[model samples]
Target: MNISNYIDYALLKPSATEHEIIELCHNAKENNFYSVCVNSSYVAVTKQLLVETDVKVCSVIGFPFGAMATKAKVYEAKLALENGADEIDMVINIGFLKSRNYVSVLRDISDVKSAIGDTPLKVTLEISELNKNEIIRACEICLDANANFIKTSTGFSKGGATLTAVKIIKKTIKNNAKIKASGGIRDYETAIKYIDAGADRIGTSSLIKSSTHAHQIRNTKIYRKYIETIQKTTDSAKPNNTIKEKEV
Candidate 1:
């Protein structure tokens, strides 16, 4: 598996500098990553940097915390689209979901999806905050809201994506929507676990590592095994070989 094509190279840290974003775009272009996920403010610059490249620009809305008003989130999504973001990942209203106000939760997501039209919205459920049933319900709500993807985390949550969470999401989604497993996926082994558990995309910041660190990743047991498998087969469409690993 090349693995590079499924990645959404990300640099969403509040402290990320313009130089870092430039480096990120360069790395993504070099690796043929699927997209570069970033904060809304940097979308325009990222879009410009990745101009004429196959790499897409994705922006997050109501990140980390989803306590913002629905209108605010909608406005943010619109502004990001205007800034040239090709995809949107929005945090679901955790409070409303916990409050059992399904109507408001549905409205929050549907409104944003409505505003974005067909722009491919991925609703971040922040799975760390929810129980198994909650996770299933969130997947259903995302489907009703017409979200294109059900993301597992914002990577700033108390926990990151889990194998169990991905399984639950996959069971609930049943191909209705895709899954993006983000947070704490630090190595090729962990990334494969998520993919095996039914994740369509893996999101992490490890892919943006230094050259030395990148060498270490390439040498990891799972990565080496992947290389061996690639050399042994010409078929590239194997499910295991086609999953995405985004740099979040």
Candidate 2:
């Protein structure tokens, strides 16, 4: 329950090399950032690197874009798990969601969840493209699909997580599912503010830099409070077995 607890410290990049991934995973394991988020292709290597550590291997499915066929997403999820991914962060089909094709969205999430079984699923809602009402509805759809978490953005969007969006998502989910605020969160202050606004997880590429000096104190305080709140909420929501944390 410290600054370490709130960070999912992402390392997502389309151009990341194997050597970079190895180094990144090593550093992530050393620093004890909650988890290391990476592309599915590196799940095997990441698993190998994080072997004995508590740091999990979080792989993205359907990646920065979620327009893939549903079957492809399901296959991708299964493959990632088979390769040692502990969690799957999948982007929702924004096109489908915006069109109000709720059934397709629900099915997409449900299929991936079923493929992964107990492995946690964090469905990216791409908040920047969603209106307030759509954001609320997306949260409801995610919950109804039995998604474990609702994520804010893909970091490829026009904008990323916003305080207002996080608040609305929290209100819609109401602790039934957690929220992950990703994209454009570069500093400790911005990350802490999101946590205070009710984000259970933070996904940012600036993990190392953000953990520096003055802001560290604030980040620690906010993250600890977030974890404490999580413990209490999880205690009442379901059994410990059901509260697995997903990175990415």
Candidate 3:
């Protein structure tokens, strides 16, 4: 399916060393993936490495968990943008969403959107924590807030992306926003199903692991951080799916 263009090559792991981050950016540029998603701390280096390439630099804000105050998130987003981040993937305040504080949730997303101003914000809903109605409401809020994408999970949570969830999300957004099916899409087949079901982008660490040249990384021992952890199944691993949890 040529998932390359639709992939947000991720490396959001706490244990990810500087060398691995550099290699991640270099490989992304060579593979022509849509973008390289990393924690905000590594955004600068990733951007610097991929400056001349077409790859976009995506930085996560209020990562893993989304309970940070709105002001803190805005500041974080601004700093990421200042550091050359082309995209911002922020976790939605799940606590607020679960508490039915839709207004706060919308405002949080809107404030960041306003700060970034067309940088393409992807709001991670952490779908596993919510019910069907909550997921739909979150989509509605994201659309209202003008978010560019509604990401399925953070991979650090209980579950990753699911086809049923994607379908439901697509049905909810109804072309207002795109769906980024993340969490656990390791192999080609699983990634394809998410695309077919309605995912616009596929976030996985499995690209390098599933590629014909996956062995190329073996000699370098570059796949150590995620040899068997983080991604539950080998079917849906993204480029840099690490289970390191950093709650805000």
Error of 3 at 171 (Å): 0.4
lDDT of 2 by residue, 1-248 (tens): 25666677777788899998888887787778889999888899889988899998889999888999999999989999999998899999989998989999899999999889999899998888889999988889899989999999989989999999999999889989999999998877788889899999899887544446646777889999999999999889875565667886
Q: Give candidate 1 regions above 4 Å deviation.
A: 208-248
What is the TM-score (0 to 1) of candidate 2?
0.84
TM-score, cand. 1: 0.84
lDDT score, candidate 1, position 139 = 91
lDDT of 3 at 29: 78
Instruction: Report the C-alpha displacement of residue 46, candidate 3, in angstroms.
Output: 0.6
**Could you estimate the TM-score for every candidate?**
0.84, 0.84, 0.84
**C-alpha displacement of 134 in model 2, angstroms?**
0.8
Which structure is stronger by lDDT: 2 or 3? 3
lDDT of 3 at 138: 94
